[model samples]
Target: MTETAATNEQISATLVLPYLNHAVRMYEQKYASRADIDAAMRFGCGYPKGPLTVLDELGLDTVHDQLAARYAETGDNLHKPADLLTALVGEGRTGKSDGRGFYTYANGEVIADDETPSADDQPQLRHDIKKVGVVGTGTMASGIVQVFAQAGYDVVFVGRGEDKIAGVIGGITKGLDKLIEKGRSDEATKEAVLGRLTGATTREALADVDIVVEAIAEDLDLKLELFRDFDRIIKQGAILATTTSSLPITQLADATSRPESVIGMHFFNPATVMKLVEVVTAPATGADVNETTLALCAKVGKVAVSCADRSGFIVNALLFPYLNDACLLAESGVELSVIDDAIKAEAGFPMGPFQLLDVVGNDVSLAIQKELFAEFKEPGFAPAASLEKVVADGHLGRKTKKGFHDYS
Candidate 1:
């Protein structure tokens, strides 16, 4: 290595010590699980791994020197290494070379033998998909249409009425225009995307499509009814998917005669922007169907995680509970601003809970809470009375101009 490059590496190694020491101390205190700590570092701080994992990777001696220097400078408990870390460093059982430390690395890379295998290992999907059908014309539906069309797939956007279909096209155009104004897309790309998008006021438009994504309202009966109608028209072997966040995939599958072809392709809000897609499989769903859906998500530049048909799946299952807790905190007489500030300052959340609630819309929160509480009946899942009152008052959120805090 050049002298300057080697010197920079040395400097980085020295600087990492205090951070590693703090991580080790936090781990010893049992403040959070190793996996969670690692996730926080990766998500919150944009680090490759948690502090302990990095120390293990960089060598304990290197981390120790940095921590010792930090301790000399600050004399704080945070700079002190945990007993477990100290003992490991003392014995020189440093990372990859020793086949030990926080994780076992084979050939200097962490092995995934014990880690959960991803769904991507099965097979690459055949992207012979020339056409796709997206039902519903809401914000999410428009976003999905934009995503598919932008990827060069002929997309049919279906809604109940001609006016609604036109509105969806307008929404897509507005979104694309915003992208152009921001210099994210060229005029040709925008025209190409719009060219691939077609709006229809009937399910008949989906007849020639290879994949059908239902982005209808989050009503199980309405979705099941649509699936029943769709099954009668859609071509055989076509993959049936839903964007439902809370409904059971099995219930939607039961609406169709070919349950084996049905699956859940849940996308987050502003579908065009989010990277994660939950590819849910019902009990009767065929392996090929799941494989194809996952492949489609990847083709559209999304990360897919396959999961069993369950309420909330992965992200929502863990996230909503935390949000529910925040609601309860606000309902317990804490000032909305104070509750938000406390969580943001103490927990490092990007937005305070109340602000997030306002942004997500109280009506959406109430609906999700009702579904969760009905299924699990956990006391923690209980909906906040304040939230109920806000929705009842029609102060939904930004769309309604008022919620926990008034926009006017």
Candidate 2:
């Protein structure tokens, strides 16, 4: 291979190897199924291939060696090769090349033999959730409102002001109109969806709502405050869910009288478009509440993956660390553009880490990293200093037109 190709491979390994390793560990722990784990990254994060599949393609032996080398170099436990990977290698089931690894293969293609439970086999949904309340009028909130309204639920959204409420409604209308122009929807459908939506400026409007989804800012104080209010104002046995990506769901639940009803319904941005909803369950989350949330996600045509209420949950837990490792690689003298190109070309990721960081915002990335570091207390999980410097300098990302790379 050429010099450039070698660097590309090195950078790609530096970033993705740990994630692939963690995916193996996650599978071993039974946090999620092989299928759900793969789907979470594929559909949820838009990864070209899930970590296990990537491990298969990269060859278990190859990954093991790379991870072992990385572990020796960094002395990071996360870099240590997963026991499952080592076992597979020892058994001589390297990867697709040898027709085995994390999955069975035929003719260099993965065969379908998933033994995991199907998404179709879900518990009965709660019958009381005819009316849904969504708090916040930002992009995520508006998309969620449209999702519930379109799904034939009576959606009541709360905003701080009439202008924000109207703005969310207008945005949803414009989106529906765009769909009409694309011939994917009709006037009647648009009107019916819009007719199902109601907006209010007070928390009192949500008192009668069967389920309230909080999509406000990602501040713990704000979410705890909202949860307290939700506990007081919402009816008995109603679900109080937050869309927080980084905060501890258990703490959020502790703030509410009905901890069993408090759960994390973490929807991806552009809720109408993303197919994944992580139905995170706190220790106090009721089994029925978990079932209801899963059933509701299926109702809205999303693939819901259930996980324990941990800091980053699934996607962010695995993703930001890789991105942070990429930052470290850049700080060690690799050109940002070169690292980006190598990742795209070698790993077939949707975008390079830098590109994704810019779109996601470096400040947000740093915040999530901090949360992860705080939760796991892993030295390797610490936020990259380079990432912190960029955020501190106010080069947030696309929002600020500057980050690892300049948008301007």
Candidate 3:
């Protein structure tokens, strides 16, 4: 397509139009709404327009027919028309030209009102996740506790001692306070979220919960012990989950007698902030448990993606390799500023790789990279020497007040 381009317009369209098609296909798959998909791409990747919005302006029928014909002729999966697109075309609602598409079009413009996919159309939930118990007092634990409480679920957060439990509550309060200051939440909402939180220092308190999520360290043995304990304490049909981002879900599930009830609910850091939650299912995990976990994710306002029980799941699996390469680039005497700036300006990434590493914690990044290397044994995937040194020097990132860029 770019072969004889005489101007930037042709090349830019050639690069962008395919992705715009992809975005439309993704909305059809129910990954997210046209508005959210667009918002995320615009804010997260710095795209000028969300793919679906572009498709809406360009016309959905044009994209659908092109993709459908290409798929039939070339047998390329990438060119396949989305089912939703096909249905819209069959119904003669092509796009802006005809006043209908992914968005309701009127006079060549769309109504600005946003819509959430109606929950009434959702799949039948297998089991309810009404109340949840979280075990730990760390940032992730407290973050997850806040996520549940904010979603109106009664949360019993377990910690070892009175002071530690107080600290966890204090952490949740401080986070909510920051949210309020930013106008992301309000005083009444904070009170209601806090009111839903109950503290416990033992597993005994989790006995009445519908689900228990362990948010402790990433050690396999410790997680095994916790799962075993949860198996013994929580009720017969309750679900068990781990927030381990890089560890193997199968190993944790095997530690419990009821492997079918065990699954992975890998919430991103500062659980209340990040939208993604990898809902992983081990081979032995029950269908009901998987469905319940996914339903709970929607209830708690997180976008969930199902994945197999594997190291790093999806996001970390793809993210760390790039971060590792950035470390190698910096260590090879390339100026970090040049790399960060060039990638941001040219690639349109919201944050350069080093900035992401700092936010993710070099220690955590290195840990995840090591997990990846151990599983895949790819020499390129090995942790960069610079990453190790930064971790060893105690400059983990924002949490430590220093990293690839100084935060202090």
lDDT of each prediction vs. the true structure? 0.74, 0.89, 0.76
Model 1: per-residue lDDT, tens digit, 284-376?
999888888988887898767666786665555444555665565455555667666655554445666567778888888888878777876
Q: In terms of TM-score, how similar is model 1 to the real structure? A: 0.73
Residue pairs in collision within model 2: none
In model 3, which runs have C-alpha deviations exceeding 4 angstroms?
A: 1-121, 178-187
TM-score of each: 0.73, 0.94, 0.71
Cα displacement (Å) at residue 223, model 1: 1.2
Q: For model 1, what is the C-alpha lDDT against the true structure? A: 0.74
Residue range with the least summed lDDT across 10 consecutive positions in model 3: 1-10
After superposition on all CA atoms, how large is the RMSD of candidate 1?
10.7
1 against 3, candidate with superior TM-score: 1
What are the per-model numbers of colliding residue pairs? 0, 0, 0
Best candidate, lDDT: 2
Query: Which parts of model 2 are misplaced by more than 4 Å?
Result: 1-6, 91-93, 96-100, 104-114, 118-120
